[model samples]
Target: MFAMSNPERPVRLGFVGVGSRGTSMLQTALMLEGVEITAISDIVPERVERAQQLVMESGQPKPKGFTGEEDYKKIADLTNVDAVFTATPWSLHTPVMVATMKAGKYGGTEMPACDGYEEAWELVETAEQTGMHCMLLENYAYMRNVMMVLNMVRHGLFGELTHCETGYQHDVRYATIGDQGELLWRAHERYLHHTGNRYPTHAIGPVSQWIDINRGNKFEYLVSMSSRSLGLNHYVAKNYGADHPNAKRQYKAGDVNCTLIQTANGITVTLYYDSLSPRPVDFIYRIQGTKGIYSGTLDKIYLEDTSPVPHQWEDIEKYVEEYDHPLWKKYGDIAVQTGHGGSDYLCMRDFVEAIRHQAAFPIDVYDAATWSIITKLTEESVLNKSKPVDFPDFTRSKWRERKPLPIVNS
Candidate 1:
């Protein structure tokens, strides 16, 4: 069945930004049957060489490597590469994706596809103008539990979703600061001067899928508030010296940011960004509806009519065997061997399958813009004392006519 959709050979891929995340994704891509890593690009020549070695070790010919700072554009123009996937830093995602789309190749990018309104609109407009799909490879959307919840939602188990609360709640002090107390790129660029949900896509992506954002419904507006900036300072002071520059520096970003959003269809969402705080990872994918609710923190579910006991949360595993998404049901064995609990594998498969079959990507450019623009929107609201900020209609009214994403086994 999967083979029938393809009218051509394997999908040739060019990878930009072969850093840690990019190399990890490249490894995942290598696990697939019909994916060819034809080219690799990174500013660091050593990283490019390492990625090419990984490709060669996979028994394929060594992929051509490009090491110029802006060599991603060259990968976009490569004749052998049919699609380009970038796992560059936040600022580079839009540029690489835009270059790929302009070159008329399929583009796949890591989360928060663009940083601000201008780049968000640019992503939307470029995809529309070039007739190419730029997929936001939001692997979180393909998570097993979330995919099961999505299936349950589609089957009316949730019955008219009313609200959702999700957030990127992981603490990443190590990533933000080097061991020598130097500010990392994330600290320098995102947290040093930004004061809102610097990274919202990880938490919002799956919820957006569940709520059908940018499909039949749109994010209308939001108001955001942030706690005082203290986590990073405290971290630096505790780990380094009390008089360290980082400890004394005033970070514009707060330790915790809370945002409230209303969808055009009347569903409400509560988004949080609490990465600076010292805490374990928690996405809090709490989706509530008239019929039932799911709590990702507890990994439990409750239903008014279907639960064995009234007003009690049942283990989500109870329904997993019956409610598991078809994609997981088909590929669980192999996917579990990869990253992010196999989401990386499934997500890459979706990208390759879409390219091979010339089908619309599951997460298109409009969805990318809608989910990613939250960074800028929340910043605006926080800077203005939690004033309501309207979301730009990236689709420009086309969302009204678009159908919700359909369940796909392939």
Candidate 2:
């Protein structure tokens, strides 16, 4: 662990892939105390320069910049950098993380962290061999309602959790196609050729924490199916001429993909990916247990013992207020100014604090692999008549002995 012996020392950071999302996270990092942006890299030299300007505007020295396709390796090797964070394209996430860990620096990446089973296994094996941490900066896990739910779960308010239903249900058709009706990277990488839960980490990350996945329990297997692909074809044909090549292109990704997972402890989870359809953004975070249930879609709860009336849903605001996570309670006001309803700030804070103190990350590589591998697993299952796919035990049976995540009050 490369901890600063003095906690007051800044956690120097190098950032890779400084596009829109990366730049936003850079701005968020600048809000943190005792953090130094030491270096920046992006395929676009303009983005590298822009990120450097942001760092300089923050009153820090202008960070060194790199723009080569493989420049992240250079950032990983810098002696001044204590950690490296990458918000690169989906295919680049695992490579950047692997490079950083091999260079003996903590690594953080946005979203699924890795897409394929090979990449997932490589991530787990690399972290174990190097004794370095690679965290999936899954911001959803820190959202206000989800964190409160995690707190309630830990406190036994949701007694003996038996089931959960969560999904990433957002329309991103505009993002997939350019104004000129050209295919974007997401269209090629996620929708054009693959089908299944392409983006499951956002939904599964929070659910995993609540169910103690990779801690006291682990995902055993899952079966998945997907609806026919139609949203993108309709979107393209409507916006552009019906004869446009994009409108006629065959997309493999189904508009709605569903996967049902069973945990070693017998908890069941229904996960969904519905980005192609026109819809409001709803994570559909529903958790049920022996005593009560909470519905994130409705933002309501039904508790058998605690409710004043039985069998009726009540507003969850009071329960959230009563069981707010400590991290949220302490940082709510400041975090609200950042992205994703303050989850960005809180999640980044945890990453920084863990690095500063040389503490184990709340969401470590094992959890990252377990949650991220769902993409590939779901794809395999969907293509094979929804056959059951066993989860790779990234923990190697250690989950039976690992303790549940404690409420991180400090």
Candidate 3:
């Protein structure tokens, strides 16, 4: 059982990072029935104050606020809290979470829980030794459509899933530069790493569940390739002037990176990271099974059974009633009220419930460590000119003996 033993009262929560994404999660925390924001922390006092205002407006008493350097420690040390929620930048996710686990609380973090393997191992080891839950807040895994597809896969609609493809494709030149045309930390990161799928889990997590990865199957090896970097510099030159120092900075990260991961069961997953391209956002998650296939972009699925019309495409919307995930069936309307098409709401709902009842998190530490550290493996493959890189079985052989976890109550 978790530190939180009482289910009747609200689950006391400590939140770190009240920026755009953090504040969004805070808003959801406000809506969930059994959650109470008790502490808030961020480097920006204004952000913390704003989040505190939201909590107060929700009719709860004012939450304790902490800001500036090392303020997160105050949240982790708070003995009254049942869980710690963090949406900090990539760098702080590990530090805040590691601290929360040490302080003996359930902790949930933004995607890519750790930037590298060593830090990821720390998360696994800590959770294993302490019996604390470390759930990665991978909202994509909870998307209604994705959940439907997962349910279908389990029901044998997509029999013996063989391959899956997913990616995070977006144009974000503006976020990387200041108004005066100075390179930000996000932009500088492109100049720092040679190449990798900087964002992997959003695409991988949903498909991992469908394919039984980190359970009966395991990611074996990966090969990665990147198109040369040009999109960012060109954007800088066009907007900030060709003579701008930002335009002259040599970006190490490629504009487009494609990574192929082969699993121990011979299931392959293709992942891409193209955050700087000139395109609208696209998840482009596609799955192929022995019986049929799914195309997320088109919102359609096809099957070997052609009774109505063999080999014909079927709009997934029509089958929603038949295969809607039980989680979605129960919480679909409430989920849409939160961010990311209601995925955020269900994620938080499940998290709060887990904390209150001391249940195992739906997305446990093994899933968190493997999905997050995949970034590092892809980098090795790309840096080696597309040589294959082995994915470490953070669960060792335990993944083989483990069974698939249910998305909804069985």
Candidate 4:
């Protein structure tokens, strides 16, 4: 184990693609101690300028801004940079991450890590060969509710777990309208037409954390199914088709994708994902065990051994304070003031601390590959009419040889 320290000098960091998500991450990075935003790059000149301006406006020293993809690479290879944060498009994550790892710099990548199995494998291989950290910054896993639920399951509060379900559902169809000849880079109608399970990690990461998946059980196989893309197409036509160039073209309806995962322990998890619904944003997480059942949607829990009254869903922060995950006990308070219910701060903190201390990252390469591959696997199963697909054992029994991640306060 490595001891934490206050670095005499701040660790210099570089960011690629400072857009909506990137800007938020940059804001969080600036709030942390022992970190410096030394450089930033984006394909769009305006975004690069805006990010540099934001940094300057925040009263920090302005970072050097670079435009174009090659410039991003140059920034990544800078000797002064200790780490790189890749918040670019999903397709760009793998290549940028590989380059950052090759440069001997730690990398924090946006979620889903990669779009396919080959890219995911290459990322793991490169990170291992380079001996650098490549963490998939799945912010949802760091949320207070997620950590609390993980604690509950870790302590066997819900004994002998048998099943779980979780998902990310939000509607962004209006953005697809492409008003005033604008192109929608993030529109589901634009990029997700050919993809299945467009977003899976937000729902899967928390559940996997709760079950101690990479540390204990591994995913054995999965089968996926998707509802037709009718919803998305309808929204596009009703809102966008009249003035859009592709008005005559049939818009691909987004899918409500579900994947049934079988764990090595014989437990089953039903993972859900959707982005086309006209509904309130929800990260519905539910777990069932022999002793009790916990449901996040109803904000209620039931214990089979006790009285039948459903425990109203109390604040997760309160639960974290009461039966805290050890990581939370030590760092949770420090992170609570930041965004994403404090997860963004904690994720960055862990990544920076691990790099500074030369300790294993909280989420390792294998964990990232597993979740990244699962997203692809889910899509494959959907294409194959929900056929069962075996999950490759990336660790190949190495997890048994590795020590469990220390529960900081446990």
- What TM-scores do the predictions have? 0.97, 0.98, 0.97, 0.90
Which residues of candidate 2, in runs, are more than 4 Å off? 1-5
In model 3, what is the error at residue 188, expressed in angstroms? Answer: 3.2
Q: How does each model score on lDDT?
A: 0.91, 0.92, 0.85, 0.75
The ten-residue window of minimal lDDT in model 3 covers: 185-194
lDDT of 1 by residue, 58-94 (tens): 9999999998889989988888888999998899999
Candidate 3 C-alpha error for residue 162, in Å: 1.2
Better of 3 and 4 by TM-score: 3
| Residue 145 Cα positional deviation in candidate 1, in Å, after optimal superposition | 0.4
Better of 3 and 4 by lDDT: 3
Best of the two (2, 3) by lDDT: 2
Which candidate order results from sorting by TM-score in descending order? 2, 1, 3, 4
lDDT of 3 by residue, 1-410 (tens): 35677679889999998888889999998888867899999888898899989998999989999986787887888877888989877877878888888888999999888888888899888888878888999999999889999888878887888888898887778888888888876775544455688778888899889888888998889899988898878888999899998787788889899989899988888898988878988888899888898888778888887425687778787789989999999888878999999999888888888888888888888899899888898888888889998888889799899889785742
Model 3 RMSD vs true structure: 1.5
Clash totals, every prediction: 0, 0, 2, 2
lDDT of 4 by residue, 134-225 (tens): 88888888876677777777677889989998887766655554664343756542334554566677888888877767777888999988
Cα lDDT for residue 115, candidate 4: 69
| Residues 279-373, model 2: lDDT tens digits | 99999999999999999999999989988888999988777677998889889999999999999999899899888887778889999998989
The collision pairs in model 2 are none
